[model samples]
Target: MSRDVVPTYVGTSFHVCSDRAADISRSGSRTSSLISSPSSVRTVTRRQSTSANTLLTLDPRRSRSPSRTESGDLIVRQPAKRVPLVRRTQHEAGPATPQSSAMSDAAKIQLVCTLGPASLDPDVIRKLDARGVDLFRLNLSHTGLEELAATVEFFRRHSEAPLSLDTEGAQVRCGSVVPDLVLAQGAEVELTADEVQGSADRLSLRPRSTFQALRPRSRVGIDFHGVLLRVIETGPASARAVVDRGGRIGSNKAVTIDPSPILPALTDKDVAAIAIGRRMGIDHYALSFATSGRAVRRIRELIPPGAHLISKIESRAGVQNMDGIIEASDAVLLDRGDLSREVPLEEVPYYQKAIARRANRLRKPLYVATNLLESMVLNSRPTVAEVNDVANTLLDGAHGLVLAAETAIGVDPVGAVDMVKRAIEAFERIPVGLDFTAPGAETDGALLTLR
Candidate 1:
């Protein structure tokens, strides 16, 4: 009536030892109790294996029964049949291995999308969430105080991603225009501080001091240089400029002046917007045109506790004092659009590389904004150069990418986000081959040796 029994369950313990004969001889009568009768089941313990095929295996087929030793102890071998391998998902596989961790870190590169008329609806926000936006930016320059609360509430109602209230720092902008103003090259136009709807003959510029500060022969750029002008005459509240480059200009377009005027860090509207944001429990603020560490510290005082301060480097002064600004703020954003106005357009790439390197060295997050996918705003696809620029930005150690017009007013906001997501994933798949370090970095005791 004795039958061989083999324990199929993994990690099971047994009363019998491997050296059954010697153990029974030494124990004498104790062996009788341990073995009892052969009719009693004799369990064989299973040692755990790392192999996927053998781990957690069970087979009921008795293809090969256990064999009994001279001492009546059973010896176990392979189970009756091998269990099919069970695949595990990332979560079921337990903690991520080091190799997997390295791959996942690249996907963590943040994507910030500005919420505007095109993408501000709940359905659009949800679609953007699905497309993988880490943050939704509320550009105060475009959002009036009356609409601030409703906009913040709209985002909270639909998306779970964090909200970033972007302040309208010190930059001067044009007021409302009845229709698009078309500036013809070589035409004389009057830049006035009057808050009237703009026309081709006269454009309204905000912050009268900036208008008065314009001197004869000073160059000006509007709408990111869509139109360029040179001041011909200066007045108390207005200046006459001759259009050097002509383009159609719209409402609320940025006006950049060379020998940039000295203005306060936070404008009156910015302060009022901050109050609205605070009351709405907003904890993230992006300071535009952050000129110095002092400007960052000043706004840091107005934000809520535990709020993140992202200082934007967009002006000559901001770039000159980048080290201090990056050190003072929680994160840094490089506005290449405005920056190009201050520095030669050709030098923006160099600035991007330098800023990215410095931010990486300091262990601070750097987000690059402007023109990442400008063409995507109108077309369904991005240009090849745009895609390459995004890939290079990631290679430069940018922690995030911000899409302003692309997602804010683009025809295909979701498509734009998908493009950025693909770029990030593609970058993650690249095999890390070289270990780059600063020129003066100490080579001794380095974790990774440059090949």
Candidate 2:
């Protein structure tokens, strides 16, 4: 016999047993019913106020009671109480100074931190939330749906902070390296499309297209800018190169080939992540390696309504297509780490200002991510330079700051968040006159003119 499937709100279907029906009897003008199913047997009390269409299910065995009605039917009743949804607010500590008081009511900067082993503890997450982390980012690049679901559920149970599902969009990286090979300067190496044991001489480059698109004289960066390889020859399935710079390269580290438009904007893993995000009720999604307005629209189709889409600008193509991407996306993220590989190191600041300017002009939220506090990954405090970078990013009209490794694997996740909050507090101390001509000014000049 075919089983009747019952759809649930939790994105899963369960079979319902319909073979047995409830037997109703009247005892002293009171109606009692014995509801029997394959799962459990329960007694339901009939009330004049109870709707006829109401469906009843037996409570779990642990919660079941031996109470019965006059007709000897087990007594069951619908729950009379429910847990109310209460919104939790973060409390800022310390004595409120003139600067802190002025900035307290001012527009607050949103802080987004990536989740990992370092910040997985519920108590740690609670501390981070209380310290003012507005959202938690789940990087899908490192974990799959099963693991992601559990993590999301845990956060939902423990805190009120929303989740941002970050997709590993079309970003290519080295798959595996054997023995953690180290390359010396002027040494020849091969980047092959096939999965093989990587040595100092050859490494595995997945997606295959990255290898096929290579040309002689092209540069390849390995291990997050650790080493550089200059392509000397290209073939159908591999490219031969010489180590321009030497360093220790490990397995699963990111690899960057210069001029990265050859990579796709969306990958199969990204598609699966979107479906899971929708079911999990993710508040926002950060699309990595975004390059064009068309790519943003395609991802929008997959995402459900009410969820914000953030386009990560991390490549030369993404920078060139900034206007279109900003227009299409709810927000734009400046991924400085990967973007530095596409453009000159010195030009990253210029690109950041340019992108921030355009995004602000369009009234779109701009997020500055990556290396905001590199020192804090190991240190308990941020260096002056790192703090200055965060302050300058805020001055550039960024609406948010994204902490990746600093909070994901850092030694002090709470300290990193506290530092970011202090940086924003410090930036707001500079009092400036409002300009109405500013496209995305927080307030109109007329409002301040009366003062």
Candidate that would win on lDDT: 1
lDDT of 1 by residue, 185-293 (tens): 9999898989888888888998777965789999888886479999999989999999999988889988888868988889888888888888877777899999888
Model 2, position 183, has a per-residue lDDT of: 90
Look at candidate 2 and tell me the lDDT of residue 230. Answer: 93
Best-fitting candidate, scored by TM-score: 1
For each candidate in turn, give its C-alpha RMSD to the true structure in angstroms: 24.4, 25.2
> How many steric clashes does model 2 contain?
0
- Over 1-451, each residue of candidate 2 has an lDDT whose tens digit, in order, gives 0011110111111121111111001111112222222333343433221321122232344322223444454432221111111121322211112343333213467788999879988988999878868778888776666687788888777787767788877677776777758899999998888878889878888677787778898888887646999999998888899999999888766778775537677777778878877787765788888878998888888888646778999876787677788888877889998887766565566567657756655656678999999999999988899987886676555778999999889999888898888888765543222223334333432111111
The residue ranges of model 2 lying beyond 4 angstroms of the native Cα positions read 1-105, 144-146, 176-181, 194-198, 232-237, 259-261, 430-451
Q: Which pairs of residues collide in candidate 2?
A: none
Candidate 1 lDDT for residue 190 = 90
